[model samples]
Target: MTATGSATLHIDAPRQRVRAVLLDALSLPSWNPAFVSLAGPAVVALGTAYRITVRPGLKGTLAYEAMDLDMVRMAWQVPGFAETGDWRLVASGDRTLVHHDFTHAGPIAAVLRQAYEGVAELRLGRLAQVLHS
Candidate 1:
């Protein structure tokens, strides 16, 4: 079984700014608490593996699954989960439209639908704060 979700938000920041924060390993934990820490290159590159520690003492290696520089799109593999996530950025003046899509596969996916949506919304909302802070 698989469950998927998409969340989009217009952030009052340049596309480059939003893109930098979203793709940076060190910057993720500021907005998303699920990521406790990451040990790897600050600039994510294809084929690079980042050792990540999350809340509840879970740890795993994360990698860049796919990236498209020209299209301003990228995806990362989540550790210890049958899940995949991607982000697309579109710039308009000083604002950036951020689209985050997620796909999870597992027997518990149906049960996780509500929680996944809530978390995605929270993550997107917090990205703005991360920019200002």
Candidate 2:
């Protein structure tokens, strides 16, 4: 992995419920503060193209076009930016364990990794809360 980081959060819900929340592409802008909007098909299957606008502080929006899906695991790539290594969903008793691994690509990877790590933590926390609620 190029720029790797992982965070695990225990959600007070079943694995299916947590997965459902994560797979809801349209609801991302509503739940995640960093995401401005998402444009594409509602269902995210393999090879589905999506355009995401990310607000990295006040430096304007960074647009990324990528293909993503969950084949019992999450995988995505933003060409010159980075690729999400693997997003694994593990079942732990009544709770769910969410694991995300990402690898940065190209020159500005290090900086992007740092920025993504911060945003990822926040997003994951929100996901856990949404499932628990």
Candidate 3:
């Protein structure tokens, strides 16, 4: 965890609904362009390791567990990189506010950190659209 970034998104959906979709790793590709596929249990459980393929054939494994209120605290390992992140959901009236914070430290940490910051907003926007729908 050498670099850190955070993004917050507000979705017009119930907190539970948003949390459900977020935890559904199998459905990730339907909403997230970065994800090509995910192989894991129907529901994410603590200590359950999952494999993920992102765009351009990048692959990784993530074993995440819930912290509280459906928040996911995960550590992922890619080919030459590693990162940890936390995804939290909070109710805002009838809607939900999603907060994601991640940190990565590796040989190319600076480059990835900059890239993450640049695309974080767009990624969150896609997530919002999916959550709303």
1 or 2, greater by TM-score: 1
TM-score of 1: 0.82
Q: Give the TM-score of candidate 3.
A: 0.84
lDDT tens per residue, model 3, 21-68: 767778877976767887889877887888988666879887776646
Off by over 4 Å in 2: 56-80, 117-120
Best by TM-score: 3
Q: Candidate 2's error at 6, in angstroms?
A: 0.6
Leading candidate by lDDT? 3
Per candidate, the number of residue pairs that clash is: 0, 0, 0
Residues 5-88, candidate 2: write the lDDT tens digits.
Answer: 667667787777777776776786778675666667777665555676655422222222332332233343343454554446
Give all candidates' CA lDDT scores: 0.70, 0.59, 0.75
Q: What are the per-residue Cα lDDT tens digits for candidate 1 across 1-133?
A: 6677778888898988887776777767677787788788877787688877766566766677666631333333344355566777788899988787778765555666666766656777898888877
Worst 10 residues of 2 by lDDT: 57-66
